[model samples]
Target: MSSNAHSFYYGGKFLSKVTDLVRSEIEPIIAARGDEFVDIEYVKEKSQNYLRIYVDKDQPGGIDIDEIAALSEEVSEKLDSLEPDPLPDPYVLELSSPGVERPIKNAKDWEKANGEYIHVGLYQKIDGKKMFEGTLKSYNDEEIELEIKIKTRRKTLTIPRKLIANARFAIEF
Candidate 1:
């Protein structure tokens, strides 16, 4: 079979094993490449398993397909060689750039993103609302200062950083 066909067939059955492989090795590779490993998950659907990897750097365009492909190839080789089960069925391998909408995954990520606009949602209503989009001005030990603009008005709202249920860099277009 062609290399493409073989790879396509093999990319459907390794998740936990591959995750373990990447969670241990791929982070270092990403770090060395000046990027951060945001997340790794096994996407299982019926008879196929998809390995999903998310990596980010301080700004947009920090990650690319080459990085993902290199990581995927390395991880695949490592798993193919080290697995106790060796050839445990097949699986699909995917490496992707975690675009602008990627979630802020760690403190370092947040710190690097300071001064950028972000979209954040709260678990419960705060000051009668549960969502806020603003410039991430500053962050202290407890809360984050957001420069929010509502219509023709502007205000700096202090929100506990921990209270952010989810946050992501907003697209500036």
Candidate 2:
């Protein structure tokens, strides 16, 4: 088999295993620190692999750099002792807060996003629109209400929850 095909099947599976193991190792440490574990990804870019971890405080305000540094130290110590190491040597490990364009992954994200500008992706077109960027006024089990701009004018659009594929905090401009 060609290298591309071999990688297409095995590389991703191996990468997932690495990411999962890393998450299992670090998530408890993060939770014990009273923070939310947003996400973890292990990927290769330009011949180097990156183990990026996104975390946030459960309370109001962004997580501080000092806290992130301490957590990173703790996480490094834990991963260092893993019997079967999953990470590749020379991989870049990053621990930080999810910044301006963070994905909305849980209930707290939704609540924090209320009245904030965001990008919404849909599974199919809703009135010829498969996506929207607007102020998220509110959301519930059934749908979300967004105030969007139509040229100079603005209107509130009700989008069904079932149609949403992804939602994320976004910057306007």
Candidate 3:
């Protein structure tokens, strides 16, 4: 099969085909171990292609290196046995926990993060601030409410969801 057939590209953007394949193959293995798949990325950086998979424990404490190593080995073995490889070129396979500060990519992420400290980056500045960090009070389809601190006082900021470019869990000092 042609390399193009294994890839999904349109309008000068490449979507995650190999990543999806890898995710599909490893999801069951991860779930059986009481872990959840957070995200996957297949990208070329500095002449090297990488397939990075992020996994998190379903329980509270989070996953560790040993779990990541074991999962990596299982995923590697499965990929090696595929008769027709999904990825045409060589790539490094990475598996690990999403860490303390994990990117919030979707509504599920936001929902899981309610009442947790988070940082949000906006595409356009709101109230002269492009970035905001606070406890995620609530979120909905239209907006999110964050309880921010201002000079020893607290204030709630309501930001439109459309204005946010990125969001992630945060560790406040």
Candidate 4:
């Protein structure tokens, strides 16, 4: 309902500008530290405003708590020094990993997720389902082979690449 330079209120929420600015400003700082920036969320939970930063590494071990702590300190200092700060005081700045159930966001993520238990979201329903959880068998630019559970049996589904809205690593219980 309001607008400012590169910032706007959508659905009575001011998310875009703040998240965008924060993302842009901190990406270089994150990259310089050899970390991959996953996402940032600026939102209110209960009476508190939170700026939650999600970060991860492509390495086998993934990012650890010490790295998160160090990054949090550096990012806090960087935000505090910004003139005309977009973030209000009394807001919580949190930095953490996206964890094991993280989304497969790009080609690299896809490559890393091969043969792993995963979830896929589709734009349209297939077999009366828009979402599926299974082990990823294989993938190409054209499609993916997913081995899913049906009743007491396992079945492989060949889904069109274009139908995937998103994919993520999943936990099978």
Candidate 5:
């Protein structure tokens, strides 16, 4: 499953430095436009380097391509003007929305996901199940409540926050 959680290779000091530098340089510009910065990442794939920036609107309906294009240009210009380029290798910069099945990484993500359908993966089995798909009822620091279907009946499952290995929005067919 796709997730916003960075892989182990991306958690090193070098990647952390690049992420910090990019966030510090671009956050103010993004905030000035009244948009929320979801995340930023630097990764190497197929021998090529990539820098991706995820953004979303504070309101509903999400961001559009035009908005992404405008922000991309501004951020590109900002990076280009940095006195000493932080990245040692050339990388492609990408700006876009976190898609429908976006990973629930923080409080804001959980807040936005309330009442939405989601898939939760546990580090250990809960009720003999390691994974669950349900309508997110509520979430707080201690736990998350979901309304799940089982044999034609709906049940509420209270999952401890510590047990969740991953949680993300799920599209229902």
Candidate 6:
């Protein structure tokens, strides 16, 4: 076991800062193009480092390939031109659309996911269960209302937004 597991490492902190800078720099460009850049996540596994960008559009499912390619090229150029340079090491940069099972992270995400089947994990149990799989009826910044069909009746359950541990599109065949 590593004794440094619980400690904050400088390299990790620096990487986080770099990712933040990249996210901030790219958000405006994406927004101006009438799209949203969801998240900038750094993945370090084994001996490889990956900078993954998740983006979304108003329509459901994945975004267009041209949009992804364009954003990737633009971001690459900007990052390469940074004065002090954000990243210290070589890494693989991947820009792509968030797919069907994409996570619902914010109010806009939840709103966009409305009317779709979703699986949600709650921080606390509700009706003896901490998980729910149902159709998202509606959602705002404060709460999400899911319509769960049980028997012959449909029930709408209101869940506080912050109580959601995780949520993602539930694919049904």
Best by TM-score: 5
Estimate every model's Cα lDDT from 0 to 1: 0.70, 0.82, 0.84, 0.85, 0.85, 0.77
* Candidate 4 lDDT over residue span 1-173, tens digit each: 11123475543457557877777779999999999998777777788878889998869988999999999999999999766677755889999998989878778778988999999999999999999999999999999999999989999999998999888899998
Q: List the residue pairs that clash in candidate 5.
A: none
lDDT of 1 at 166: 78
* Candidate 2 residue-wise lDDT, 1-173, digit = tens: 00111111232344335666677778899999998899887767798877888999866777999999999999989878876566536778889888879898678889989999999999999889999999999999889999999999999999998899889999999
* Model 2 global lDDT (CA atoms, 0 to 1): 0.82
lDDT per residue for candidate 3 within 96-135, as digits (tens), equals 8888899898777898899999999999998899999999
lDDT of 6 at 96: 83
Model 6, 1-173: lDDT tens digits are 00111222242354325566677778888888778877677667688877888887876555799988988898888778865656667888888877778887777777778899998999999888899888999888788899987777989999998888889888854
Q: TM-scores of the models, in the given order? A: 0.72, 0.81, 0.83, 0.80, 0.84, 0.76
> Model 6: how far is 117 from its true place, Å?
1.3
> For candidate 6, which ten residues in a row score worst on lDDT?
1-10
Ranking by TM-score: 5, 3, 2, 4, 6, 1
| Candidate with the larger lDDT of 3 and 6 | 3
Give each model's clash number: 8, 0, 0, 0, 0, 0
Q: Candidate 5 on 12-106: residue-level lDDT in tens?
A: 33433567777888999999998889888787779887889999887778888899999999999998987667765798998989888888989
Per-prediction RMSD in angstroms?
A: 7.9, 5.3, 5.1, 5.2, 4.1, 5.1
Instruction: State candidate 3's TM-score.
Output: 0.83
Candidate 3: lDDT of 137? 96
TM-score of 5: 0.84
How close to the true structure is residue 141 of candidate 2, measured as C-alpha lDDT? 81
| Candidate with more favorable, higher lDDT: 5 or 6 | 5
The local lDDT score (0 to 100) that residue 173 gets in candidate 2 is: 91
Candidate 5 Cα RMSD (Å): 4.1
Runs off by more than 4 Å, candidate 1: 1-21, 32-34, 45-48, 57-60, 82-91
C-alpha RMSD (angstroms) for model 6: 5.1
